[model samples]
Target: SLQRALWVRNVTGCKNIHLSSKLLLEDFPTDFLRAVTCQVCDHLLADPVQSPCRHLFCRTCILKYIRALGQRCPLCTFPCAPSDLVTPAKAFLGVLQSLLLRCPREDCREAVRLESFGSHCRGHQEADEEGDGGQGQTFNSYLPVNKGG
Candidate 1:
């Protein structure tokens, strides 16, 4: 639950965020996952970057991978460097944000849109701090799912 709450700060690329791959909807196409997921961590992208080889990876993942492994693309083995990683197009990032993911807290089974997940997660933290223990309160994002994109 703490991790979920902290993910809100991840939007600024200030920290590492980990959302379980299991939270992803099973109906989403595999091709979509391949494009959006970090090949190193196999989780939803967080501050994602595109390699010169055209493969996508979470900015943190690629940095750690190259530091631990080598200066090569993890997916294609193409020579890559920290400079080779670039922020992806805003339109592409929006698609990743629109992907719906189920809430990870065991007590909360609500499905929330990725774009709204920050507020949804914060609701849980706030409710807990208010002594609700995330029991009776519903942490609904109320933000419409961005389906048009």
Candidate 2:
């Protein structure tokens, strides 16, 4: 349930700030997780980077934000340069990948690992196009059944 809630928040970019108890605050501090979450996307860190002010964000989210609203830290309004963002430590990425998220596709709600999500989502798209009939859309011929007298 916690994973589903988290998935909904991330995919929909909803500001609903409820975190289920199953997430275990001891294992993941609420504040720390919230800090790493990308404010623009409301998703767990992806290619995380840290501002000079130590604010964390997904690399793309921050870049887009910077491009849209000058070079300033979104949280503190401190001036920020492109070079001011430093890649976050590997441990931070590891923790991010460990968070369980559901597929963004409305039809597929399977829990997907963050690291493999992109490829996993692509597979779903490809599979849908293939359908049960494959690319040729041909059905196999059924053998005739023998009737018992």
Candidate 3:
């Protein structure tokens, strides 16, 4: 009856079998977390978009790269177009937004949500640009992707 009642799979193809406890950020491995990171900027993803070739990137990063280089997926160098990109599914986004990151500031160990990480780390953006590599912390609940295309 349980099997007949429901089935779920994460975007990465991991089957969702347990219903009692939700997976926490601490449960994932470093490699799993790395897989979700944006290849271009090497930060936890912001406004993540998937290329036709199945590689992910921060939307802004991909757009900037494409505008400067050419229409291509940065990771695989597959020919890509602006129109060929799509934001992750809401379920996927929800999972991403749930990861926790500590504030990059040495003084602040406060954890931040993934969805608001950009704003939380805005103060360090300049320093990051100056080669200091800003660190920042993570979400929100929204269902825009599942409502339509």
Q: Specify the highest-TM-score model's number.
A: 1
The C-alpha RMSD of each candidate to the native structure, in angstroms, is 8.6, 15.0, 14.4
Error of 1 at 79 (Å): 0.9
lDDT of 3 by residue, 43-141 (tens): 456567899998887666677677767899867999988899887778878988777755545666566666555555554554556654533221111
Worst 10 residues of 1 by lDDT: 140-149
Clashing pairs in 3: 112-138, 113-138, 114-138
> Model 2, 45-81: lDDT tens per residue?
5566888888886666677677767899978998888
Query: What TM-score, over all chains together, does every model reach?
Result: 0.71, 0.60, 0.56
Residue 9 local lDDT, model 2: 44
What's the lDDT of the predicted structure labeled candidate 2?
0.57
Evaluation by TM-score, superior candidate among 2 and 3: 2
Candidate 2 Cα errors over 4 Å, as ranges: 1-29, 104-108, 132-149
| lDDT, candidates in the order shown | 0.68, 0.57, 0.56
- Candidate 2 accuracy as TM-score: 0.60
Best lDDT goes to which candidate? 1
TM-score of 3: 0.56
